[model samples]
Target chain A: MNTADIKNEKSVRYHGVGISNGCVSGPLRFFRQRRKMGRIRACGDQREERARFEQALLRTREQLDTLQRRAIREIGKKEAEIFEIHAMMLEDEDFLEAVQGALDDGACAETAVERAAEKHAQALRSLGDPYLSARAEDLHDVATQLLRQLSGERPDGDLSTEREPYILVADDLSPSETVTMEKSMILGFVTFGGTPNSHTSILARAMGIPALVGVGAVSEDCDGAYALLDAAEGTLTVSPDAEERCAFEEKQREVNDLAREHDRYLRSLINKPAITRSGRKILIYANVGEGREIAQALLNGADGVGLLRSEFLYLSMDRYPTEDELFASYHDVVQSMQGKRIVIRTLDIGADKQIPYFALPQEENPALGFRGVRICLAREEIFKTQLRAILRASAYGNVSVMVPMIVSEDEVRACRVILNECMEELEREGKKFDHGIEFGIMIETPAAAIMSDEIAREVDFFSVGTNDLTQYTLAADRQNPLVERICEENREPILRLIEMAAEAIHRHDGWIGICGELAADLHLTQRFIDLGIDELSVSVPYLLGVREKVTECK
Target chain B: MKEFTYTIEDPNGMHARPAGKLATYAKQFDADIRVHAGEKESDGKRLLALMSLGATCGTELHFIISGSDEEAACEQLERFCRESWGRGE
Candidate 1:
């Protein structure tokens, strides 16, 4: 099947990766870059040409500033920072000197800017860092804006000029260009080249628009042609015949109706308890990072926060966050939960997650190196400070303290000793805090799960971090793509470990929950329930769906 | 002239954002600041030049400040390195 012929023919189906979720049909318009630049007459004097380049730079700076403000209003601060970086690149000394060098050689302002931009972009590309090398594309984007300002060309990819909403077609859209477009004018997005993880796909998902990427090439002749896009099926049909159009419309109606009904049904289950048909009640909880996510968890009908990673405060600061700062943040989150249990996992850093202030040693195998409980144990002051804060916050609500990467009962005992010390210090200072705060350990390693029978006597409960338990048990790094499938296919060993942990914890009169990717795996929900798992904690979006699945479990 | 040495603490090294920030901050005074990363040297006011050093997290950066305001620049730059660069934020 020839792609070009299909693109130009009637009722041709093109396939690409689908993003977000929706179905729509509208006129298709091709997004083209403005390459035809108007040349300014170069004077015989070098100074005059240099001045012209300076003016374009100034205008480009002003444009970027305006775009930054617009992006902040339309998108968010983090995304808008792209424009801020662009502004800095525009003023880079090396870039300026390169442009000036081109001008001294008597190149016109437009040509000089293009040449300078390419030179810097090339330099960045050769740096061999994937992150920094990606900045090369950003350099080209900034230069394009400067060139457009110099040649007095209209902004590239400005969809606001289009009168009606249309499906957008492009080879690929840069983050800056995508954000600057008039969003209302976009009915959907079609790209000939891009991955599902591209910024265009992320923005499309954020806007809740149908998008198809890597659909090969759609001809410029196809612009303004009526087309139908079904993102759920990852298909874009150009010039759909009457029959195809009718079928597409019916499918679109079904999709829309199904979405609305599903949302309503999930919302209806919000306030109900997730009791299995076998008469076993399971707690449905949310996994959150910080205080900011409490509202989202509440809205999604989470019974409690099962895994509240306490790394957010430490990771964002330039220094060891004071005990008061940590306490205040924890207090707010605890109070917001309104008596619901929130398990605050102590700083699970060192592997993948690094903070510069920690000055952690470079590890040959960080996964097996100093991390989680080991780091907390080595740095007793940091551990004590965090423990003190969590204990103080427990006064306001139902709070549980969970330690990660515990491979032995000795580590649990050490943590308990420090926890006790902190409690004594809090009492001495007359700080009102809950005396009976629940303590727990994450069964994330094979050793921890195997020894759970003994460790269960130390902590109040166990929440299996299946992500690590799977990796550690199978001896495969899940982050390695080649070995990832092994971890997925080898869930039996992980489930068996969870079973061991569940049985051990129950024997000790303690409860067990799962707070990993496996927790939200609906396919394993019934199996987990059969193994006597008592709780499932997932991210906020999956809370309602998991709740519904729990009721279906026998 | 006043001089000081500080080690890079950011896992990302001297990437564009921090380099740009350092350059912007260096433009405040009449003193001339130079950063030496082993055999490579870069003007403290030049973002691209600083990034070109490709200094990784543990690389030491030697700073030399010279001019009429060398005293103030040295004190502030040392403070900046301790507070900002040391934390790598």
Candidate 2:
């Protein structure tokens, strides 16, 4: 097996779909599935065969129970549920009956279990539902366990003898196989056949291990070879030369440093304020789409919910969501924030984000057409319902109302009138709400940026929606691939508009924040700090990185 | 015999989670239960059997119960259908 001297060998590169993101270098070890040592001959005694089958079932059950407990401890309960389901499948009458019938025909317990599993697996495959059919693999996992028990074979092959962590190479891995192995001993995974949606891929992602799947066949001789597995680039290099090895080590060090610095080091500073060197306290918040993401936002250490797009509830429903339904969602999100400032933007749907039930007439350029506050003001009842819900939720926590797409003071005053009516209605109904909840507007349109001075006085704060501002200011449609370069290159004009809004809002003693894609751009963190932006709100994943960038900035 | 029909509203349909839940729940009943999905039918007490029915979203499940505990089983199964698969939203 020691055919090639790894040091003198030329490097071999293999490509596949990168299911997880990371880079690792190690000696490659092929994980071979432990098959039952040959065919099982029928035992003459039927009762003895029955006893053997029963004992194997009992042992398999115990092993599954242990795996379930270990999985729950190491991984999450959600991932561990597969083991619970497998345990249930063990006692499934169809499976047990098939196995018993095969045993009655004088087949050994191993053959009986194998045949029964194949029969049920074939039946499941013929069902034609892809998700259900995938359970065949799970069924096979259970059968393999049973066979192992009957044959008294070890759960895994002898890879535990290796001293250092090795890259696990296999044809594909079952969920049981992935979970049962010691994750600490494995650096990464390279599979010959699997998908991004495979159980192994999902487990690898959940465990934060780099993996490449569906890479086609790798030679058995490559085993024990020094390798570089960079799942970020979806490539595995075997027996890399000195130069290649140097490059691989450099990349691996950078990835390791980043994972350690950003995830561990930055996460330690999550509760700390994202204060700049010049002593500007820039609040870091998360832009979440729905109530379900509130937990994630909180976990990522968002100081507040900066931009809660209210369109999710409306878009999910066939008709408009009722005020109570909207209130239920908003109430949960607000309560979860636990008195942290949560800015809930009213429904900003239009031609691009049309709810079929809205039934607005199609326009030539929907972006320039009636949208945001225009649609809300046109439909006062919808706007009022949302306002009432937000107001109702204000009683629980620090909630704020932020209007979207305001081009003029007229639109601001119009929304104010409707908001006041909703407050009055709430007052009459005796609903307890924060009477002095903060009000703000999204500075998206160029006209809104130009008229920020007049608009800032009416609202408590301003949050610049830079995605829309960039497209509108540059006269470039963001979705157009042809003008994508134009949109990407032109940031100075958008930054200037944001600077104007920041100055105007600060003049009124109201703070300004950027709740846009640009907010997370670390390149502009120093630029944004210079412009006197009070807050930055990005998606949950970028929260920590942006926080790190803010501290890195002058 | 007690019988009722329910359309699977869960987008993923009778996958492992729901099927296992159904099998586990049906095991508690003394009544003989059978679930039918389109042309295929399965013993409600078995997880693999229920899964073999391959019921996807929009597939109607006709549940038939027969035994001494049929009435209680019928009522409970109906409630489960309304609570779990009932959200036609």
Candidate 3:
């Protein structure tokens, strides 16, 4: 069909899995599978052999280096670091030996490199460590690039076809790859492999892209066939009929209208407080991880930072950040807030976030073990360093120290004792600080929430970490898709805990803040407001929506 | 090396706002001036690089001047990083 005819054509029956959000009317563009290069032939002449090997190595390094630099520059430092492992692998003696061995065996360079990579990959896979297993994709990417370069094949450019309104179908997409795609032309994304916790999924959510992953053969089956993706339902249709398309289009239009209305509402409240008609004010803060996020949060009209995860400072560093390193970080955050209250949570690393330098032993149940205040208590020196840094920064701006995962009064008291010691030490050093800095505890565990009244009397504030609260209360892993129904935020127990926690804090004349997904939930915003949450801290993207909801709550 | 003070005009001060401003301006000059706040000192060019200094508003900090355009660089930086007269509480 001609371009004009296709633009006007409404009856073309094409099907594919939906990958991103929004609806667009345009011609379909299919992604071609990456071609694999075959083995290289062995050269009898040593000179030719050496030249070919060096050329291959240089070419592979250039491609990998370019990808790494681009990833770092465009995506982020974390995503860029993923390529460093591949770069190291290329220089490994063992890997080079394997490639050489393949060349010696009369195999083509492409086949030799692929064979070497496959063998090493098998060995790595057998080791079975999650950290190492995650590197498997890196290994694959490097090997593929080497093979393609050696075999004289050009590396594929980003999926930048001109066909508009195409649903991207893939086996899996890295965060960098996802960012490279034409966001406007891409309607949605469907993948055969990915988890909700995956960075790809997180980015998709941030971009308001509707993505369905773990759908087997959906991509292949629906290629060139029109399909409907129901992201809310996590379903992908293949070769959907006219009725289905019409229904989805209608639904998309409804969503668009709502979003437009939301945008208008958000624009109206750009400089306004999240106060109801009854004159009740709600402090809408932003949950920040890095320094860059602070600017984004303030721009989105956040009153201040509700939760500044200090883990990023340590995570981004190669080793444990020295006292000075920690001090600099805290100072940056405090200055960024510009006199606005910033509740800095001490390193809550454990479970999914592991620091290699600390060498924390693996726990049978990381969620319930050796994390948050527990880890801080055991590592007093590290904890003290963080506290000192926080105290030192407090002089610069409004800063508060928050303890995470406090399951008992003793843990809270123990943390307070250490914080007091840090304060004393800072006093001895003749440093200026907010001696009466507000202290808070993250009510993540049910035990902590149930005993909120007791904890509230000791601390100045409480921040509900609903992500962990739901996981702990429901005893369902948030990462597990099968247990998703059980781990819903609107569950009766969750609401009850939130209500009780808010009440307990209010009884003590202490404020309660929520720094979790539930805090940003528009549907539950009014309910939370009614429950008497003093503050709602959410991702920067959802700040406007939450602020609008707060205004409508009365 | 010469040391001078400047008022931070940006609302957020030396953290993200003034640091970004400093980074941009520093990149334009041939000489480098290291902005110091607390124990942190950052090369005046990079945004993430300059923010590493952690300078807050109303805080008097030292800027070590060296390099080719050190005199002009210090004057501009001191003016920017310090609070203006009657501006501070």
Which candidate number has the best TM-score?
1
lDDT for each residue of candidate 3 in A5-45, tens digit (9 for 90 to 100): 12233433333333444453322234554735664465556
The estimated TM-scores of all candidates read 0.56, 0.53, 0.55
DockQ, per model, reads 0.13, 0.30, 0.01
- Model 1: residues with Cα > 4 Å off, grouped in runs: A1-258, B1-89
Tens digit of lDDT per residue, candidate 1, span A417-514? Answer: 99999999999999989999999999999999999999999989999998888888999986443355588688889999999999999999999999
Fraction of native contacts, model 2: 0.85
Poorly placed runs, candidate 3 (over 4 Å): A1-174, A179-264, B1-89
lDDT of 1 by residue, B1-89 (tens): 99999998788888766776677667776999999999999999887778777787888999999999999888877776666652423
* Shift in Å, residue A82, candidate 2: 30
iRMS values in order, in angstroms? 9.6, 11.4, 18.1
What TM-score does chain A of model 2 get? 0.60
Better DockQ candidate (1, 2): 2
